[model samples]
Target: MPAQADPEPVTLLLVLEDTETLSSLSDIGEQEGLRVLHAESAQDALAILELEPVDMVLCDALTPGLDGHEVLELIQERWPDCIRLLMTDVSSGLEEALRAIDEGHVYGFIPKPWHEERLRLLLRRSREHLGTQREWMQREMALLEQNQDLIALNAALEQRIEATQQELKQTAEMLDKTYDELLHMHVTTARVIGDLLHHRLPRHLQTNEQVYALVTAFCETHALDHTLQQDLQLAAALYNIGKLTWDDHLLATPSEQLSANERTAYQHYPVSGENHLMAMPQLKRAAKFVRHHRERWNGNGFPDRLEGSDIPYGSRLLGLAVDFIELQRGMVLPREVPRPQALALLRKFAGRIYDPELCHDFVKLCVEKAPDLQTSGKAVISLETSQVKPGMILAQDIYSASGMLLLHEGKRLDQHLMDKLKNFEEIEGRNYTVLVYRP
Candidate 1:
């Protein structure tokens, strides 16, 4: 490596009135590797301090215009980091030197005529103090930069976290809306299947209405959840969907009068109905309700043979509703049983074929609530396809000109169903006369 260059000398500023004293001090400072700058007055010295990089300042005690003490005080105010020293002769008052030191304007005073060895020693010590202060300032600047970088990074991280939270909220809302649409589609499909069955087997229209009404009343009385109540209502409307696969004679025959093979086949309708509903993922819960609707409280019913309490509550409610409707329709006996006789028969089977509590509630609902639902003298009006609207309950079954049942009495129309009826009429080259409840 090349020989190392000598370090740059520290700059010192000297303010003095006497040219001889300034020259002598400049010679001493230069020998000790100090670069000396001379100012004849305090004003000149202050001007030098503003324009130059200075490491140390020395002032003669008797400088003209401004005293050495006043010059040091000005340097302390304008350049607090610059090290200061005072030069005093034997005639200079000891009180002035003491005041300069006490007021912190000077580090210490040097006596004149100055000794060469002592002057050299003082200059070396002052340069070392200046080096230490510069190093400290450098370290402080570095720490400030690091703190600013950390603050910026923390703000960026907070912004990213807020953005992620907003995205999650939007995703949750979209999922909720998608779920609602899927539920609406599933319900519309079930109603279409129920309408097809009602057209083929006209009696089911009345039975579906009675069972749904009874189930609704029973669930309300028991304070069941709205989700379960809605499931049971859908299951009741679509209960006999499996009968579509049955032979016409088997469907027409009363349950008590069926042959052993016919009864066994009839029992499989619940399973078939569950299979049909399971095709739609959104209807899985209602499918489960339909699958166990025939299960007995004593576990003697077909398919799963699930016992009391083990049977789903919605299924138990459905069992009571279906049996009660079947009895009133005379599907369980040769002649149509009166509503009072149907209630008695349902009570007789409670705890064995039905949940005793639900059976009791069903009886109360039928006796107290059934009368209000009867449309004995209610006005029924016919409407062309263009005149019909959603939310209107059907007052009579709508059939095609060829006697094909298009919709059932008590089935509430919606936009989708109304569209289907219009499409069917257009396809068959006939206009349908839709009957709706007046109120």
Candidate 2:
């Protein structure tokens, strides 16, 4: 048979006066995996206790010098962590037994002339107590490791949160600088367009206040923030700035038959806006947005051909507003479709010409706030020789008698027309609609 695993050993201190009893107990202890240190008297056991560490101390209550109670008291003081047990043959010493239990901190009592099974039982209980002590030590070590890990994890999380907060602060500053640049570029564009309008008109011309009013209404209706609303108004006010660099013939030319040069000149507005804005880094982001406003959402429109969501959000909003204001001024072909019809047409081209979401918001805003379209305020339109005081509409299209158009429409005018009026001058048999203005 395979050698049985050695039973767990226990250190025991035995105090006895008789040699026979010590020899008998030693044999039984060896069989049960107990390591015994024998003493002839209680005094000897106390000396042993001072010299070595023991798990349990087994002693007699009535030893000659320094009884079991005396020896236990010394053991309790020196090795307080050790378990103590008292053993005696005299029944008369039972009273002292109670005293040993109370004052000596003894763990148990064993009668003399000890039975083999009884000694085995006592040792087994002591072994179990030692096992419990070891298990407790293991648990304490595991808990200490877990606490250290938790502290490290908490420290790492705090560092990440601090870094994220710092990054957000920088991003906010960058966005602010970009907004200021957009406004400056827009003002420059307006001045150039205003000068051109004055040069072309017979009397005077100016951008309409109705444009600003409509843009403000659009922003409010769509719940756009203040900065975004201002950007939209500025963009619409300056969209036709490149027209100033073109010849008077083209500005007044009908849209249906534009010369090749006229078409090319008209297409340069976005570039003009970009060139003026890119001098400042803060303005560069806005320049990009402005340059791409004419691009189609379906990869088919001018300059950049940016498609769908690829176009900057700022440019998309501006494009929708500019188209609306131009249509109201009768600048576009077909005598500028009515507001309802214009919105309907824009909706059809959403996701192809303008951002689909912005288009939807623009249409909803116009229908809900239709009255803001009425024109107000006066802006000076300066020409080469003289500056117009305030009340002339440039590019007004008058019709011939034969259903042929005779004039063009401007993007903005000082006076707002209540509606388009029909004209029948110079052409035979047919009539056309005229873009009329009141001085």
Candidate 3:
């Protein structure tokens, strides 16, 4: 094994006018194992800064050209990374020194004829702070590099998945660690696309989250594979992304309102969303589910008309979720119905339009989780956004000014979700009547 090398010493610059203080600082630097350089004036300090990399700068408050605060402020503008300490006469320039601390120009003020103990402590802390700053910068650079690699990985995901299942699992794990950073950049891309859908389709706000909630609940209740569960959740967010290609007229019209040609165009969205997502390998399973979400149980569904158990299990669960939410949105029908009615409408279509057993299991999951859906008579209260608390079950969906559903009925509130609602209120300037079933 090779011997390790020594760490580079800390470099410091002194622009002190007091000869006694300058000599004391140099002795302390040597004890601290620092590479110390002294400057006669502020101008000399600036010149040295231009030539050499410095970790910390100590400037005299009463220097010949610029006072200590003024010198540190100048250092801040040119080389803001260095830790700065100022020396000042406590009585004469106290206000100027205080203002420099407030404005963040000077890191700290050292009174003239400083105590050795205090000076040593400040220097030790400054070294620690510099180390932390450098560490954070390294992390930021690494994250940027990871983001570029992630983008490339997302681009070639299809080819990579075909190579080996072990490699596929490894890629999935990386995507998990930086899940928020995977593709579409910065945050989850599906969420970004979901927001886009919220803008283009108001019904999306009303139904998308409900779809996700239903799909996830069903997946969990059935104890589905963790990876497949993640794929279904992503699919639930994006099943209707193909609707982006539709014209405003087609997008705005209800299914019952659409003409034959428009209906045909509407049925194409599931396939369209799948095609858009197919190039990325990680999302292939999700895309497959999105592609077949419109398929029916008895071969009446569109695109390929996959019937009964022939459809992928995730797609089957996803389709049931989509219909259950959309049925209540009045998206597939003329008039909007309440939650209990929506469940009934979903049940009515089970055998012919949906997988019967899955439909039955979904209704049971809904009734058990959403107390307000039951006829067991739970008291419901309507509260303002600020009044709602965590653990309370939402009795009704909260909608945006644009009629996009912000939070779905039966969703539980946590501090994070409360913060989201507060931010939304601040940004959108809207108030909502939040209904919660009493615990």
lDDT score, candidate 1, position 320: 82
Question: Per-residue lDDT for 186-275 in model 2, tens only?
Answer: 655654544455567433123334445666677776688766665555555555554656676666554445768777777787888778
The TM-scores, one per candidate, come to 0.57, 0.42, 0.46
TM-score for predicted model 1 compared with the true structure: 0.57
Q: Give the range where candidate 1 is weakest over 10 consecutive residues by summed lDDT.
A: 366-375
Provide the overall lDDT of each model, using Cα atoms, as 2-decimal numbers. 0.79, 0.64, 0.80
Scanning candidate 3 in windows of ten residues, the lowest lDDT window is 179-188
Clash pairs detected, candidate 2 = 395-408, 397-407, 401-427, 401-430, 402-427, 403-430
The TM-score of candidate 2 is 0.42
Ranking of predictions according to TM-score:
1, 3, 2
| Deviation (Å) of 93 in candidate 3 | 99
Q: Which ranges of candidate 3 are over 4 A from the true structure?
A: 1-187, 203-205, 371-438
On residues 22-72, what C-alpha lDDT tens digit does candidate 3 reach at each position? 988999977887889999898899999999899999888888898777788
As a whole number from 0 to 100, the lDDT of residue 155 in candidate 2 is 87
Q: How much is the lDDT of residue 154 in candidate 1?
A: 88
Cα displacement (Å) at residue 209, model 3: 1.7
Candidate 2's C-alpha runs over 4 A off are 1-83, 90-234, 244-259, 296-300, 304-316, 334-361, 371-439
Please tell me which predicted candidate would have the highest TM-score against the true structure. 1
